[model samples]
Target: MRILLTLILLSGLAAARANGYDSLPAPAPAVQSVPAVQKMKITDLQDLIARSDHPLIINFWATFCAPCNKEIPYFQTTVDRYAGSGVELVLVSLDLPDYFPARIAAFAQSHAYTARLVWLNETDADYFCPKVDARWTGGIPCSLFINNKTHYRRFFDRQLTEPQVDLEIKEMLKPAP
Candidate 1:
C-alpha cells in the first residue's frame, strides 16, 4: 500500500512536470487593500485651482448621473489627446458617502480611467457648490477650465461634446492676450 501511494504521488508530480507546471510559483504574499481615489475637501480643490501653473480641466462627476457617465469618454480622450501639451485634467467624484470609495474606485478602475481621481469629502453642497461656481446649482457633468498665469477661466455645467472639449482646450492653451 505504501509503495502504491508513493507511485501515485510520483506520477502526479511527473504529470505536472510534463504539462510544464514544474512546482507552482510561491503564492503571492497577502496584500492590503488601498483606495484608488483620494479624499479631498472643497478647500483642497480651491487650493489646487489657485496653484495650477498650467491649464487645468477639473471635471465634476458622480457614479449615479447618466450625463456624467456619458461624457467621461470625452474627457478621457481629451486626457490622451492633450498629454503632450502639459495641460492637466482631474476627475473629481461626488458619489454619495454611503457608496463612497468602493463603487467610485471600481468605476474608475473598470473603465481604465487615466486622469487623476479625487473624491469630495464634504457633505454640505451649500458651502462647496459656490466655491466651484457662483451660479452652480449642484449640477453633475460640470467642468472648470482654468489657467492661473493666463487668468483664463471658463465654467460649463452641462454635458460636453468632444468638439466642445477640443475647442475649450485650444482656447485655454491660447497665449494670454
Candidate 2:
C-alpha cells in the first residue's frame, strides 16, 4: 500500500514538472516606454508599415532559442549605431504569453537593449507565420527590413551577423527618397 502511494505521488510530481509548473515564477507585466510602438497585431503592423515613411527593421526571436540569444548583442549594437536615426528597430519575441514579459524584461535589463521589445502573443504559429512573412518557416532569429515602400528585404531561417545587419541598414539608408 505504501509503495503504491509513493508511486502515485511520484507520477503526480512528474506530471506537474512536465506541465512547466516547476519552472520560474510568472513574468511581471511589461511597462511600455514607447506607446506608439506597443504590442501590435499583424494587421496593426501592416498599417504601421503603410504609414511610416522611414525604414523599419523587425527581428523575430525567442528566449529559449540559443542562436537567438547569441545574436541579441549584435541587434543591440545595431540599434545603438542608428540611435536617433530614422530607422526603427522592432524586436518581436516569439515566446509564449505566459513567460514573455518577465523573460523579455530580464533580457533587456541584462543586455541594456533600448530598442522596443514587443511580445508576439498569438498562440497559432501556423496562422501567424505567414502573416509575418510568407518566406519565414516559423523559425527563430528571422529578420525583415522594409525601406519605406522602396524595398522589402527578409532573412529567414538563420541568425544575423553584425556585418550582415550593417549591410542591410546601409542599403536601406541609401539616398533614394
Candidate 3:
C-alpha cells in the first residue's frame, strides 16, 4: 500500500513538471530598484485611490496580448519623463497565475521596467471589471487615469500613445473649470 501511494505521488509530480508547473522564478537582477511584483485585489486598488495624492495611471496588460506589448514602450517612456511630476504609473498584469514570478519577472527585468508591477489576482472578469469601472468590458491594454483630489477620472480601453497620456495628465492637473 505504501509503495502504491508513493508511486501515485511521483506520477503526479512528474505530470506537474511536464506541464511547466514546476518552472523556477526568474532571478533578481544585480541592480534592481523596482519593487517586487505583488498580487493585487480590488480592495487593494481602492486603497491605492484613497491613499494617493497624485495623479494615478493604472494600465492593464497581459503577456499574450499584442497591443499590450506594443504599448509598453510608450508607457515606459511616459513613466521616465514624468518621474517627478507626482505621476504614478502602475503596470497591472492580467497574465495567468501560473506564469507569475517566473515569466512576468523575467519580462519586467528584461525591459528594465520602472513602474510598479502588479498582478491582478481575480480570474473572473465579471467580478473584477465592475470593481475597476462599470463600463470596462474586460479589455486588455486598458488604462485608467484618476485624480483623487478633483475626483476626475477617465478610462481608455485600447492602446495609448505617450503624448495622449501626457496631455490628459496636463488637463487633469489644471485648475478646475
Candidate 4:
C-alpha cells in the first residue's frame, strides 16, 4: 500500500512539472501601445500604395550602414519640405529586431526627424524582400517613389543627397494627369 501511494505521488509530481504548474503563474497579458511612428507589414505597404492618392516615398536603411546614416538627415529634410502636401515619407530600417528600438530612438533624436520610422521585424528576409520589390537585392540605401499603380520609381544600391532627395520629391509631387 505504501509503495502504491509513493508511485501515485511521484506520477502526480511528474505530471505537475510536465504541465509547468508547479510554481510559475499564468503569463501576463501583453501591453500594447500606439506607436509614435507606424510600422508596416508587407501587406500594409502594398495596400497603402493601392489605396492612397498621394505619393509615397520609401527609404530602406539600416542603423549600422554609413551611407544610410548620412542620407537620413536628407530624408528628414525632404519630409519637412513636403509637409501637408499629401505626400508621405517613410523610413524603413532593416536593422535586426534586437537592436531596433535603441537604434530608432537614437536616430530620431540625433536627426530630429519627423518622418515616420519603422523597423522591419519579420525574420524571413527572402520572402519579405521580394514582396517589397523583386529588384531590391536586399540592399540598404534604396529609395522608392510611388504614385499610384501606374508610376513606380526605384533607386537601388545607392546613397542619396539632400538635393537629389528634394528633386525626387518634387518630381513625385508634380501633377500626373
lDDT of each: 0.76, 0.66, 0.73, 0.65
Model 3, 173: alpha-carbon shift in Å? 1.9
lDDT of 3 by residue, 1-177 (tens): 223323433454466567764554366667874347889897897798778898888998765555776787787787667777777888898776776756776767766666788987776777777778887777667898888887878998878877887787777676665
In model 2, which runs have C-alpha deviations exceeding 4 angstroms? 1-38
Clash list (residue pairs), candidate 2: none
Estimate the TM-score of every prediction.
0.78, 0.72, 0.78, 0.69
Which parts of model 3 are misplaced by more than 4 Å?
1-35
Model 1, 1-177: lDDT tens digits are 223323433454466457764432333334623337888999999999999988899998875555776888878797678888788889898765754576676666655566788999987777887899887776677999998878999999888998999999999888889
Report the Cα RMSD per candidate: 18.0, 9.8, 9.6, 16.4
Cα miss at 21, model 2 (Å)? 14
Global Cα lDDT for candidate 3: 0.73
State which candidate has the highest lDDT. Answer: 1
lDDT tens readout by residue for model 4, 1-177:
223323433454466457763442333235622235456677776776577777788787765556777898877777677778777877887655654575464545544556777776665656676777776666567887887743746555578888888888787777655
The TM-score obtained by model 3 is 0.78
